[model samples]
Structures are given as structure tokens and as C-alpha cells.
Target: MHIRRLAAGLGAAALLLLTAPAAGGAPAVDPVTLDGPGQITDQVGALGSRKPDVEDALRRLDTEHGVQLFVAYVRNFAGRGAQDWADATATKNGLGQNDVLLAVATRDRQYAVSAATDSGFTEDQIREVNATAIEPALRQNDWAGAAIGGADGLGAVLAGDPVPAPAITPGPANPGGDGGAEQFTASDVIIPVVAVGGAGAAALYLFSSRRRKRKDTGGGEPAGWGGDGGAPPVTPLPELDDRAKQLLVETDDAIRTSQEELGFAAAQFGEATAAPFDQAVTSAKEELTRAFRLRQQLDDAYPEDDATRRAMLEEIVHRCTEANKRLDAESASFDQLRQMVTKAPEVLANAEAAAARLPERITAAETALTAMTGEYAESAVTAIAGHPAEARDRLQFATQHLGEARTALDAGDGNTAAVHVRAAEGAVDQAETLAGAVLRREGELREAAAKTAAAIRDTQADLADARGMVTGTRQDESTADLRGRIGRAESVLAEVGREVAAGRYDPLSVLRRVEEADAGLEEALTGAREREDGERRASALLDQALLTARSEVDAARDFITTHRGGIGTRARTRLHEAERHLDQAESLGATDPATALQHAQRADQLGEEARRLAEDDVSGYGGFGGPVPMGGGLNTGMLGGLILGGMLGGGGRRGGGFGGGFGGGFNPGSFGGAGTTGRMGGGGRF
Candidate 1:
């Protein structure tokens, strides 16, 4: 298809070339010649030239697009020899491609354009120009256009003298003859052409002029010059120029006002006055108003000079900066005041400390009463230690509860002061339990460290043993014993490392196997080495063991820490219990303000109980009847049930009668009666 279309176009162009007229005859007049820089000379020469190129171009137009065009000039005229002398003149004068053409003849101007017949520059083009430009131009004696316009062949009629009609000499009519040959005069064409052209040009000029005058007189910027489409940047408004400058001055005034207000506020703040903030806020507000006004002025200016605008913008920034500084200072002062209130609890603690340590009346009174419940006992200790000012009375009450419990225990009244003592003990138990967790964590950590040291020793032993085995075994040895042992041990260790990373950290099981492997290798190597090098080899092996042990400890510590924070069953259950019990305790403890000790103790008891229970059960406990044991975080699907003993139990009870592992650690109902040390409500009558 593409080839077919191309061939068709080529054929049409060829047909055009074939149809062009021969250019063998000499021109009727020497073709007007232009040699230099004006297009007029070339234009005239182009029209007047007998050159085959020009004639061929015209013939091509005629054959292709069906247009006959003619050029007109006075006889014996000569000017220049180039193609477009007028265009050459404009080019030499440093004008642009789109600037006015330089062709002139008499008083009127002219233009020239080149066209292909495909462009439809035709005889109709001439008729239209005669109507549009030629007749009018001639009546106005537009000689320049008459000459250049005609030479350019751009649809223009040349001026010609009107000829008077000859007297009619009617010859005797032959059988087939027409009456006569009609003679056309120029007047018949020129009058209507001139009238229509003049009226159209006048109406256009009048309408455009009136609209422009209206826009100017009505105080609008001229639309034609530059509308909102960004023809060029327009000047700023004159009315707002002074307003913009005044805005800067006013902003200075606002700054002064704010400064004055700040000074007043600062003086008040120094005097420990509460009203300073309000005054400072008011001043800041005024400054903000001034800033907004200044911004408005800037906006009204529309566009401004760079220097003045920069100065204005800078002044606005300065005002804002100053206002913010004042606000910051005020905020700092307010924060200091707020800190006094926020630190009340700490201050109260200090006050209680001073009172308790002194041989003061409050401490003496507190000492007079006590309670004997483990809960009360523990609370007594915490109160004694903390000596929180707000809690001093509560502590005194706790001491009383302790005294009561001790009396009941002595008198064999097991229930006496039991609830209070237990409540108090729960508080103490929490601290102790927390301390236990820390200790257990530390012990676990140490045990882990030891395990890691042992593992490292094993790896080093294995590595060393591998070295020894490989050392003794020739590279060509086919024995599977040495490489098989080393490869198996390395694989096991790598598996252990992955388990540790994945939070299935089974230190006991993994370490036991590792220890067995190391022992077997050490024993095997010991006899061989001793036989080979006596004690010297032992010393080197021992040194390597020491380094291996250290590295193992370090690696294990890092492994535990990296995996410790991950979601584990025990940690998740504990965290959930903490959140739940804290929320519950906070809700329940707010009642009975005078019995604040009882309420707060109950709340604390509940929370600590929840936490201890969560850890001790190691089995899942339902939170507000939600699903049991939110499984150990990420790897819960696998090891979660094993660690937390599955979520099958209800009522916070340990699951399934396990003996020593998880559920055996705590029995809350029995715990309440057993006088458990560090437990809430233990050894107390509830």
C-alpha cells in the first residue's frame, strides 16, 4: 500500500512537469533585474523574466492546481537583477523574518510571496485583489503598490488609463454573425472595488479605535498590550505602591508594639505573675495582624521591583521571626510554670522522705500502727522506701494493716487483716517479682553465656579437630571418618544458629548435642596428640579453647538479644496482662477516695496478679474472654503452643496438669493461703 501511494504521487508530479509550457521565447521586455539587497528588484524580475525556470514553475502550477496567473509592469522598466530585491534590502538592514516588507513605488507599500499552483494562487486571486486592494490603491494613487504588487503577481491589478468606447459601426449582419465585439472599460471595475474597500477599512479602524479608547478611559490596563496570558509582565499598580511602602513602616510599628508588649509580659513573668502569658498572646496576635496586612499590600502591588520587593519580603520575615521569638519565650516561661505542677509527685516524694527519716511526729505515729499480711508487709516496705508524700497516710494505714495481720497470726485469726496485708504484699511482691524476673533474666543470661562459651569451645574444638584431622589425613586420603564428623558437626551448629535466629532458641537441647560432639572429638584428638607431641600440643589446644569459649559467650549474648525482643508467648501474654490489669486497676481504684489505700492496693494487687499469673502459668490465659494466649509473636504457629502450653485452658488456670514445666510454677488459689512471700494477699484473711 505504501509503495502504491508513493508511485501515484511520483506520477502526478511527473505529469505536472510534462504539462509545463516551453520557455524558448525571449521576454517581451528585458526582465527587471535586481543585483543587491531589496526583494522588489527580484520580485519584479521574477515576474518579468523569460527564464524557463519561472515559466516552468508557473506551468506546473497551472497543470496541477488549475490556476492561470499573470504579471504586469510598464514597458522598458529596469531596476535590479536579483530574485527579490525588496527582501534583500530588509535583510541587509538587520530586520527580522516577520518584519514589514521594504518594497515601495510611489507612496503605497507592497508585499510579495512565492506560491506553488498547489497553493491556489490563481486568476481568482487577481480578481479578489482587484476588488480588495488594487482598485482602492489606484484611486488613492498608491503607486508603490501598483508597481510592486503587480510585479509580485500576488493577485493585484495594474493601473491602466480608462479608454473611451469607440462609436459603434454596425456592419450588415451576415446569416451567422454576432452583433459586435463588446469592449470593456476599467471604470466598470474600479468604482465598486474602491467603495467597498474604503468602507471596510474605515469600519474596522473605527471599531478597534473605539474599543481601545473605552478600555483606556475606563482605567483598565490595555488588553491588547498584555493580557493575563503573559505577553509581558505588567507594571505594578500605582495606587498600591505607596501602600506597599507604608506596610513596611506599619510593620515596624507592629514590631515595636510587640516588643513593648513582650517587655511588659517579661516584667510580669519576673514578678511571678500569671497574666503575662495573656498579654504576650495579645501582642503576638497584633503582630500577626500586621503581618497579614503587609502581605495584603504586597499582593496588591501585583508585581514589584526586585530590590524593593526583596526588602519588603525581608521585613515581613523579620516581623514573623520577632513574633515567633516572643512566642517561644512565652512558651518557655509557661513550660517552667507547668513543670512546677508536673513535678508535684516527685516533690511530694521528697517531702515524705524527709518526714520519714526524721524523728518527726508523722513517722512516729505511722510506726504505732501496722499490719501483718504479706501484702501489707510488702506495701509497708515500699511505702517506707518510697516515702511518697501523697502516699504517707496510705503507708501509715498499711503499717496498721501489717500490725493487724501480725496480731491475727499471733492470735490464730487467719482471716484478720488478710485482705489488706495481701493487697500490700502484692505491691511488694510486684517489686520482688520484677526483681526476680531480672534475676532470672540475669541467671538465664549467664547460663546462656556459659552455653555459648561451651558451643564456641566446641566449634573451635571442631575447627581445631578438623584442622588436625585434615592436617594428618593426606589430601588424597579417601577416608570418610574425619570429613564426615567435621561436616556433620558444622551442619548441626549452623542449624542451631538458624534456630536461635528464628527464635526457637533451645539452648539446652542444642548445647547438649554440641557438647557431646566436642567431647568425642577432644577425646579422640587427645590420645593422638599426646602420643605425637606430649604436653606442648595440649597447651596450644587449651589456649585455642579459651579463645573459643570467649567468642561463644559473645556470640550467644548477641544471638539472644537479637531474638529476645521478638514476639514470644510468655512476653506477649505478660504484656497483654499488664495492659489489661492496668486498665482494670485504674478503673477500680478510683472509688472510695478516703480508703485510697484499699482501692489502690486492690488495683495493684489485680495487676501484679495478672502479670505473675501470665508468667507462671506459661499456659494461655483468656483476656476479658478473648482468645487464650495470644500466641508467642512471630513464630507462634510452631513453638508457641509448646512454650505457652497451648491456649486450651480457661479462667487463667494453668493447663492440663503439667508437673514441673509451666503450670506447676504458680497456683493462685493455693497461693492466696500459703503465705507466699512476694505475692498479693498471701498469708492474709480476705
Candidate 2:
């Protein structure tokens, strides 16, 4: 049994789907339509405990008033587009069983509204729905909302008793004329209709009729759609119904025909004759675009507030559709003419007008799109300049041609104007490419200048640094070179000191011997300086002494040629042996002739060298000073010098009261025993 029932339900659904009429279908018959003055329909359903008045009203509308009533429960709003919503909307509206939905001429010149009813609605309730919801939705350009809200609000109104005063608000102001004084009325489509039960319906009928009469007689006030009263007068747009859109399309076609004729005439004028026809054509084309744009503006602006704006937009959409059709036809004609040289002037003129038309429209669209999308609108340049270089060139050429057109226009040469406008479009196309190239060049120049400036600064700094170095104003290469040399010399000195500390050699002994030689040379040189009269003789003696000193130094150099070798010179060896004997004799406090002789000879050699260098050498700056021996806690020198000769006779040995004091235990001068003859055990005295 359940399976059978399910199948029956499915069959019923299929039947309904096939039979249901489209939402915009023909006007419904009596009882299904909400029309006429003072006539109303009651829409209500049976509750658990149904009200008698509600049920009776439903029955009366269905039977006496020919109203149809129904009840529908839907799961979601998706059902709004379905037959369910249509039936539900009707059920919520009351209509006579035989009454039809309102029938207003589809091709009327004013706005019209109609509805169907499966559920009937009261007259007052329908008014309330139109005011509170339907009207507002329409004004705001919310068509779908207007439809759904009209249904919903109607339902709410019909579910209750009629109030003395309905809760409906007034409609928004009419931008085209005086607010409440303006009215839209029906025309001469006479169908005897039963009125609804309200003053509201009566008012609607009266207003509709008056508007229709005004339209027939062409007596309606000349007012633009905008509220600005001083605006140019505009003919009333066709009635906003389904067929209104078709009317707009027809109008668009008419406009294009007019433009084409004008353009042909314009071309003829350019043949070295009167150019009036060409002027007329250009003017006509411009006027056509202007008229189309104006219509769009009206459609967009009417219904001054949210209450009527939606209807206005819908009307505008129709206008746009019509305008687009005309545009397409004109464009196609232009394409055809473009292929023919005779019609080329007209084609070119049309293209120019089109180019001009797009800017304002695109701008307006961008603003609208921005508001709608909540993002930055595309730049005007981008929107108009199609793609790559082609877009740029087109725009550039167009602009240039426009300038030429303007010049021709100013000069009253319409033939030339047409030609120039064509050229301008081509110029417009090249603009983008030219602009890009210019920008690239500018960027490169700026970058090069920056690099040049930086390089200049760097060079200047380097020059300044070089100059500073020359004068020691800055620590430069020259200064650094001198510092490095000084630092190296100090390092060498330090290294030598360190070697002495580490016992690398008998440093003290070596130093003493070097000091003794240096001292004798100084003394001899000083004596040579004192004798001016015998300078030559003194210089000769000094020269002999210098040779002996040099010989001795040479002998020393040969004996101690290297640290790793034994003394190699015989003179150095014999002298060194004699010094040792003298040293032993000195330990016994005895003076030896042999040791004394060796010491004297060594001392004499060094002293003579000093004399020669100081007196005989002409390069000597002045006199030389002799060495001053320092005393210590040891015995004095025991080996006396062979002779002393400070104030004594020159060139001869002179005796002294103790010619030499005891030579000390260690004396640098005793390295070569001075005239020493004593052996250790055979010393004369101790």
C-alpha cells in the first residue's frame, strides 16, 4: 500500500511540473487575480482551532469573489522559484474564485504590476505588503526581494483582522515630479472588474486611470527622470513591463537608422563641395550616443530612493539591452562600410564617436564595479588601452585624430573633421608604447647620473688623501716607509742584547778590546791636532801608526774569521800567547819585558791610526778625544808602556818617574803584551 501511495505522489509531482505555467505567463482569470478598486481577497489556513471569520472570508473570496485559496509549506527559499511559491503567494492573497490577476497592458508607457493567487489576500494587506516590503525592495533594485517580500508581507497581513488604519507606509518620492502629486494610470483596456474592499484599491485604480489618460493625450508634464527640476525635458520612458524591454530595442534600431543616413550624407559633403551634410552626419552620430547615454542615466536614476530603485535598475537593464543591440547593428554596418572606400568616411566618423563614447561609460562602470567588488578599479588607461602596443597606438591615434577633428570642427570644415577623427584613433593606439619607451629612457638616465656622481665623489676623496700624505698631514705611504726602517733598526739592537744575555760570547771582553783600540786612535789624533807647525811631520807619523793599527785589525780579523774556526794568523797567535805570559807574570806582580813590548806595540798601532784619521785625513771635522780608562777594585796595569810622550821630546822615548802604574788585573790594552820579557818562574820581581 505504501509503495502504491509513493508512486501516486510521484505521478502527481510529474503532472504538476508539466502543467505549471511560467512566472511571467498570461494574466490569470477571475478569483486568481488581485485587481480592481475596493475589492480584496482573504488568505488564511486552518489552524488546530480555526477562526470562523477567517474561514468564512476565505470561502466568500473563493465562491462569491471568485478567489482561489491554497496552502503550501516549503523547506527552503529555493522553493521561491518553484510553483510552490506561486501557489503559496496566491494562497496568502485573497481573490474571487472567478476573478483574474491584474491585467495591465504589457506595452503601456507607464509602470504596471500584477500578481496571482492560490491563497487570497485582503485589500488592505496587499497595500501593506507593497508599502513595507515590495515597494522598498523595488526601489533598491532588489527585484527578487520585491517579489518574495510581496508574498511574505501579504501573508502576514492576511493572517489577521483588518485594522482601522493599515500599517503600510507611503512610497518613496518620485524624482521626475512632485512627490505625491505624480501618478501612473492605466490606459483604454476596459475590462469590467469587481473592486477590492479598501480605499487603497480605489486610489490605485483612480491614479492608474488618470496616468493612462494623461499619456494618451500627451498631457503629462515634461520632466527629466532626475529630481533636478531645471534639467532638460525628456520624453517619458515606456511602461516598465515585460514588453518595455522590447520597446527599447525598437527605439535603439530607429536611432541607428537615423545615424547611418546622416553619416552617408556627411561623406558626400567631403567631395570638394558643401560639407554641410558631413557636418550633419557627425552631429547626428554624436547626438545618438548622447541620447543613448541619457536614457541609461534616467534608468539608473529614477525611483529616487531604495523604495523604487530596483525597478529603475531593471528598467535601465532593458534600456542597456536595447542600446547594445543598436550598437551592434551600427558596429556591423561600420565594419561593412570600412571595407568600402566610398563609405570609409562614414565608417571612420562612427568609429570616432564610438571611441569617445566608451571612456565615460567605462569610467562609470569602473566606479560601479569598484563599489560592488570592494577593490581598486582598473586604471582608466588600462581599461581603454586594449593590449600591448596595439592598444597604445590605437588610443594615441584616436586622441590625435580627435584633436584634428576638433580643429576642423572649429574651422567649420566637417569633411576634414571626419578624416582627422579617424586618424586620431590610430594615434591613440601607439600611445602606450611611446610612453613606455620614454619612461625606460628616463629611468636609465637617472641611474647613470647617480653612478657618475658617486664615482666623482670617490675620486675626489682619493685625491685628497694623496695630497695629505705628501705633507705628513695624514699617515701616508712615505711616512709609513720611514717608520718601518726605524722600527727594524731598533729590533736588530734588541736582538743583539738578547744574544749577549744568553752567553752567546764573552761580550764584556770583546767590548773592552774594541774600546781600547778606539781610545788609542782618538789620543793619537788629538796629539796630531796639537802640533800645527810640524803638521806634515805629525801627519806622516800618524800615517805610519794608522798602517800598523790597520795591520793589527786585519790580523785580528784573520784569526777570528768565524766563531767555529781556530785563530789562523801567526802574528795574532804570537801576540795572543805573549799576552797570556804577561797575564801570569802580572799575577805574581812582576813586569816582563817581552809582555811589555807586545802591549806597547799593540797600543802604539791603535794610537797611530787614530792620529792619522784625525790629523792626516783632510775630511776630519775637528780634533779627536782620547779614551778615559775607568778604575775598578783590581790592581792597576803592571805592564808599563815602553815610553810616555805627552810634553816630552817629539819622535823619541821619554822616561817617567814610574812610567806606567801597575797595569790592572784585567786591561783591554794588555791583550798584546807590551815589551814583555819575563817568563812565569823567571820573573824579575813579584
Candidate 3:
């Protein structure tokens, strides 16, 4: 069949050679010379007898489907990629809105296909034809076969037929049997003539000879030949001058608002209220400066070249956006700091009131400890004695920090005051927990034991459910570690149970261990459950994202078709990229749902951007404006100020205002028992 086709076109082949340039020098071919709106230009001459057939097919398709198809055959793409060459040629030739171009670099063995907005074929159809038909034939060194197969496949798809499989045959073997020139029919002579003229044919012969020599030495695919499809249309730059100017104005306003807030905070709260706010103000100032520089650059850049201008404008937008965000955060921080400064004195009074009652509470704890010691032997009630002693020590520490907090507040150091207050509060909480536990053990031993047992059982049930969720799924190290922790907790619970059964158990001790074990088990169970639920949720999200992405791609494609003239090159390119990403998301959905979601989200974003650009709706800086007033709160420093007065005045035994002389290790189970210690008598701030 191949031989017959080659033989029948002998006459056309002769005419092609008759037009060839005389042998001497093969002049360089300009890509523009061979590219036009509705024509197939064969610059490399690889089409041979098949050129007419491919051209006829394209012409017929255009006439019937309102689509234009252009084919280009080049000897080399120079240093340019196949996709780059195709895009440049398409743009330069002023290809029609409904045109498609198939560019093949025969010597380089690379090809790319590009389509205009109204081109009837979708990207998927183009990719399929390239993969199943054109690429296979090209890989086998059958140029005519690729051209014919690609044309047929594209035409069939346009006509609503499934793409046809490539019909390929081996090229003739080299005559010398030493891998010299491949045997060719008389028709082969005309291919080079049509491509580069007669002189070009001489150059072709020499080029073929060199290829054979290279093949003998180190054989590989032709220099540029590969399976890469062409890139999408280049994104044309939007008209960004007005957009940049608007963003600049908005950015300046944000900066001014931020500066005003900073000045107010410094004046009202003394420059040292909160270190974080101060740092944020400084950083925002720096960012504002950078934004100004970027704006200047944007202004200097000309929008004559759409690509360069768009890139410059995008940078400006990014810088301005970040500046605005930083400024807003700084302003909010200032407001919060101002409120805290205003409330400091009231907070101080409240702390003093609370401190006034601490001494009496300490006395009651001491009485309970003394009773526990009298009822049980010191050795038996050893655990209960330690907690109350530690509570006394923590109380002393809390007292000292409170006094320091007062000094800092008096000096207008709210940030320092707040830090001290937090430390004081933590110590107080620990002391209170220890004292309460000791008291509870002394008064309600039996009840505490029962509650501990119930907690253990509940935690066990939760652990079991968590274990069930991850039974067969692949488990990470964290999950495995959680399982081990749960097992340890169960072991601890069993030990507590054994002690209880033996009738020799210290109720306070047993209760403490049980609580610890329950906490650990509950934590482990929660972690495992969250891990399981997170994966399930991620998979579901990915599925929904993929569906949405597909819908977006379809909408973008439809918009391009309906408004071909209205859409710019950049928008059309973005739509193409959206489709590509959607395809990738679908492929990755099963194996990597998280990654799949990322791809789908990107697709959706690009699709929306394309639609926005096409509609010329790209003028605004869409971001946060000047800081709105968030509700205010008191600063931690004010609370610290209150703690200071209480610390200095509330004297207890041990010579510390509250926490002094409370230092001692308490056994976890020894709380709530009677023991004797020196009567609480410390009365000075530590």
C-alpha cells in the first residue's frame, strides 16, 4: 500500500524538484515565510508525496467544520523547543480564531500542536491524536506516515469519530548493509527539493551521510526528537497600568493608617507596652518601604510587551498585598495593647482582694494534714504529706513573682508585668491542685477510689474504638507509639486494681496513678481517632474538589468558544493549563488524595483567573483594608500589677507572702490526708 501511494504521486514529485534552487548553497529558511493563516507550509520537505493528501484533508475539515488547520515541517527548530516554535509561529501568522497548527521539526524529531480559542478540538483530543497516532509513526522514522495519521486522527475526532490507530511500516534498509544511506524510491528525491530547493537537496544528502556516520559511532534518537506535546498558548499580559496605580493608592492608605495607630499606641501606653506590637510596627514599616520601591518599578516598566509588563505588575500586587496584611495586624495589636494598659489598675485591685483570702486557706490545709498524720503512721501516709508541702513552696514562688510584677507595672513596663503575672498564675494553679488533692484524699478516700476505677474503664472503651479504626490501614510511627502508650496505661490500671483488691492500698496513691493512666490513654485514643477521621475527610474533600475542577474546566472552555474574540491570549493559555491540571488531579486522586486536592485547587484557581481576565475585571486590589476595631482586652501586665500588691501584704508563716516555705515533693496519692507541719506563719513577700 505504501509503495503504491509513493508511485502514484511521481508527477507531483517531479514538479516539486523542478522548482528547487540550484546546487551551491542551501539558504536559511525563515519560519515566517512558511507560516500563514490558513495554509500548510512544508519547510523541511519531510511530507514528500503525502503533503497533498494532508493539505487536502485539512482544507476539507476547515470547509466543513468552520475550523482552520495549518501544518509546518521544519528541518530544525534551532535552539527553540517545539512548543515555543509553534506558539511563535501561530502568533506571528495571525492565525484565525478557529485555527489549529501542527508543527513538526523533522530533523530534530520534535512536534507540537497549538489551537486558537475557537478551535473545534479540545486539548484531550489533540493529546490523544499525538500520543496514539502521530508520535508512534514519528518514533519509527516514518514522516509521511505521521503526517497522514495525525491528519486523519484529528479529522475523525472533529467529525465525532474515535481516533484511528496509526498504520505504520518499517522504512527501507540501508543499501550498503553497513548502515549507509537507506534505499529510497524516485519520490524521495522530491521531498528535499520541496523543503529547501535543489541546492538544499545536496545539503540534505550531506546531512544524511553525517547521520549515518554518527549512527555507526554512537547511535541515539535524532538530536531534538522526543515525545513532548507543545505548550499552551502564551498568556498575553493584561493591561495592568490602571490596576497597578489603584493598588499603589490602596497600599499608601494602609501604610498611613498603620503609622497613625503606631503613634497612638506609643503615646498612650509608653513605647514599651508590648514587645510583639513594637516589632510588628517596625516590620510593617519595612514592608511598606519595599512596597513603595516595587510600585516605582512598576511605574517605570512599559506595558508595550504584554508578557514582561504583566510579570512586573504581578510582583507589585504581591508586595502591596503583603504590606497591607502586615499593617492590618499591627493596627489590631496596638488596639489590644491600649485596652490592656487602660485596665491595669482595676486588675491590680482584684488580685489584692484574692490574695487577702489565701492565708486562711493555707491554715485549713495545715490542719487537715495534721489530722491525716495523727490517724495514719507517717510511713503509711508518706504520699499525702509531700503534696501539701510542695503547695507551700509554689505559693512562696508565686508571691515573689507577684511583687516583681508590681514593680514592673509601677515602672510602666506592662509587657514585663504580664510575663510575671502568667508565671505567678501557673505556680498558684499547681499549688492549689496539690492542696485540693491532699484534702480530698483525707475526706473522701473511698469515693476517690471508685471514681478512679470508672475513669479507667471509660478510657479503655475509648482506646478500643480507636484501635478498631486503624486495624488494617497502614500505620505511621505516631500511631504505633500511641498504641504502645495505651497498652502501658492499661498495665498501670491493672496494678491499681490489684492494690485495691489486696486491701493494703493507699487510696490517694491509687487515685493519682489511675488519673494519670486515664489521661494518657485518652490522649492516645483521641490522636488515633483524629488521624483516621482526617484521612477520610481528606479523601472526600479531594473527590469533591476534583468534581468542581472538572466543572470549572468545562465552563472555561465554553466561555472561550462563545467569546473567542473577547478572550486574550493569556486567558486562553490559563484555560488550557486548568484543563491540564484537572487531568493530573484525576490521575492522582486514588493514590495521593492530599496532593490531588492541591492540583484540583490549582485548576480551579486558574480557571477562575482566566474567566476574570477574559471579562476585563482585573483592576482591583482584593485584600484587607485598614484595621477594623476588634474587641479589646486587658494586658497581662495589668494582672501582674494586681498580683504585686497582694504578694507584699499577704504574709503567711514561712516568711513568703503566699508561696514561701511551700516547697516539698508530694506523693500523687498522698493528697487529702491529715498531717502536722509548722503552723503557716510566713508574713513577708519572698
Alpha-carbon TM-score of each model against the true structure: 0.20, 0.15, 0.25
Q: In terms of TM-score, how similar is model 1 to the real structure?
A: 0.20
lDDT tens readout by residue for model 3, 118-185: 23344577878888777787777666666667777767876678888778763422111211124454
* Model 1 residue 563 distance off true place after TM-score fit, in angstroms: 23
**Candidate 2 lDDT over residue span 517-614, tens digit each:** 32233232333333553343223223333233333333222212110011112222233333333333334322333233334345444333322232
Which is superior by TM-score, 1 or 3? 3
Query: How displaced is residue 614 in candidate 2, in Å?
Result: 99
After superposing candidate 2, which stretches have Cα over 4 Å from the reference?
Answer: 1-12, 16-303, 330-333, 340-686
lDDT of 1 by residue, 311-366 (tens): 66566555555554555455434434423222333322333343344334333323
* Number of the predicted model whose lDDT against the real structure is largest: 3
lDDT of 2: 0.32
Cα error, residue 651 of model 2, in Å, equals: 99
Best by TM-score: 3
Arranged by lDDT, best first: 3, 1, 2
Model 2 CA RMSD to the hidden true structure, in angstroms: 57.3
Query: With candidate 2 superimposed using the best TM-score fit, by how many Å does residue 390's alpha carbon deviate from the native?
Result: 12
Candidate 3 RMSD to the correct structure: 34.3
